[model samples]
Target: MIFLNVALKNIYMFQDAKLDLSYPRKLPSSTVENEWLEDFPKINFKRVLILSGANASGKTVFGKVLCIINNYIAGSSINQSTSWLDIKKVMFDKKKPTSFKVEFLTPKTAQAHKLAVIFDQDGLIEESYTCIDLQRNEPQSAMYKRLREFEPTSYYHKTKNNHDITNAGFTSVAVSQGKMKVPSMWNYRLCEVDNTSGSQGRITAHDTNIIKTFLSAFDSSITKVKSIAAESYKIEFSNGEHVLIDKGKLLDPDRLSRGTHEAIDIAMFYEAMKNESFGESATFYLDEMLAYSHTEAEQSILNLLIDTLPRHSQLFYSTHNYDILDMNLPVHSHVFLKKDKYSEFIQPEKMGYNQNDRSLLGYVKNDVFGTLPSMDAINNL
Candidate 1:
């Protein structure tokens, strides 16, 4: 399952923001072969999303919100998704309901699902769900025309003093179909690469080679990586000295440079994705853990990840590196995010950039879309 679109109102920093993953209708779909399923070519979704923006410009917040929605759909959403969110922005004080509208496509079922929810401080208040069919041989025009006219199947609202949201995830009609075809049938894996000093992961023997090879590419001093225990390994250097990672803890982590430290974390991430059983359910959300790695190395791995994505999977990557704008990615594949009074996800293709010959990097560097850093405070200081 891939999310085609997500809209938020009164959720954390978002006042009214929408992130649409579907490819633009105005642009030709000729270069987006990797963007859609082979059987469902009419649904041109944006498979690879390279989110680049200024600092604190709502990049990380967007991913966290999406993860919360994913968790809520799976019926395991925790309060932590909004635990640290701003209470004022959440509208709890104003007694308004935070709302979300999601549209996703399940390739296996050859159908699409749109789920809308509204909840207040008391808990969930209302929910609505709708399902649509997409035949394999359906014409593009017919499919899009039906999409615009999709009517909601059901919408429910709670009466006064009804606050228990535990029995609620989807409406009654949505779950009546035996949980297989409903939104809950499928699950997604949304992981953010947190590469702090004390990060942990079990690295067994089978993954030793892949880990070693990827790390060695960044640092030439390492000779071999041997699994000394169930979750421990010794990264030996050519200088007869070595580093120890026991039970997933990198002891003496400061011995390595910052770049080498990032490499270790990325090695684990790469190994996991390389061997993952990706399908409709496995989605990836990667924040920039390559702050210390070389640009070329990052680009190579980025390309590899895009090339290896299964037909039904999607990758949402976030970064502040302006160098990434120079990559050969399509304008539609990139979204420039910025903050004014409210956060917005600006699509380059929709910003009147229908022509593919323009330089996205140049436009961004010139602050054309207002994604560059605002210097009002700095200038005053």
Candidate 2:
């Protein structure tokens, strides 16, 4: 599934915001070649998006929003009383209901699906899902809508299947009749590594190659990686040194640096994707992906993400690293989040800058995107 856009209201720092993943009508000349994935020969969509902002500017909150939406759509149970939290007393009203709307497309039919929900501290208030035929510019015959009124707690549902649903769970109704296919989605936060155990046996050449490719990108000294035990692995370096990872713990005379750990974690994830452990069409949220890496290593990992990621998947990563701003990514792929304000997409031409300039440092310094924080108060302190 490819996400087209998301709209949220009364969710944490977001009062009302929309994130659009679809490509804009105009193209930036300096955009990276083959930066977009083509759904059809004539229709293309962006696969990589970067979120940037100062500390506490809602970048991570935005990532969490995606996670919430993913969990809800995947039919994961949630606590209604505590799940819906208002921004604050000043910005929130007891009478207001939080809402979210998500728009996406399925690979099989290319139908545009819009799923929306309204809820409050008590429980779900209303929900609806509509599928639109993009080719014909009309909505499909199958649609699902639910409203809560007479019974305050129960919901009245209407669908093409004509099933009578009262007080039914939103996810249950949505997943019924095989109407919605839940996509594989994962959120990778800083330093969080998958610790699933690998059996102790002869490591296949394919596994060896995958490990080497990952380590070589950060440190060329690494020669081989083998599963030493369950949830553990041994790393062999060309310099006759060894390092052991036991259950995500690094055991070496000189402990592996955070950067190394980050690389290993990402490499293992990529290897899993290569092995088809993660099904096709997954969406990955990499929060502060470059937190532990230096400039050079960060660039290397970015290159790996661009080159090795499955063509059918999409990646949304947040970063404070300015070097990323210098990359040849398209202008539409950059999202700038502001504190207590609306997030927006950056258009280079609109800001009187050429796309090929590669002078993002200057842009931020001049407040072209308004994500940079004002340090004047710090000096006063």
Estimate TM-scores for all models: 0.83, 0.76
lDDT of 1 by residue, 144-221 (tens): 567656876655567642234344432332344333253322212222433211012222434788768877888888
Off by over 4 Å in 1: 25-33, 80-94, 139-154, 160-206
| Candidate 1: 10-residue stretch with minimal lDDT | 194-203
Report the Cα lDDT for candidate 2. Answer: 0.60
Candidates in order have lDDT scores of 0.67, 0.60
lDDT of 2 by residue, 1-381 (tens): 667678888776677777767653436463444433344433345577777888877777776667667666666534433443122231234568777888766555655567777665544556666664444322222211211112122122433332555344434356554555556345344323232211221122235566667676667788888887765778888888789877656777365566676776666555554545444565666777568788877766776676655666667778889888877676666777777464444435345564645656677767877778878899899
TM-score top scorer: 1
Instruction: Identify the candidate with maximal lDDT.
Output: 1
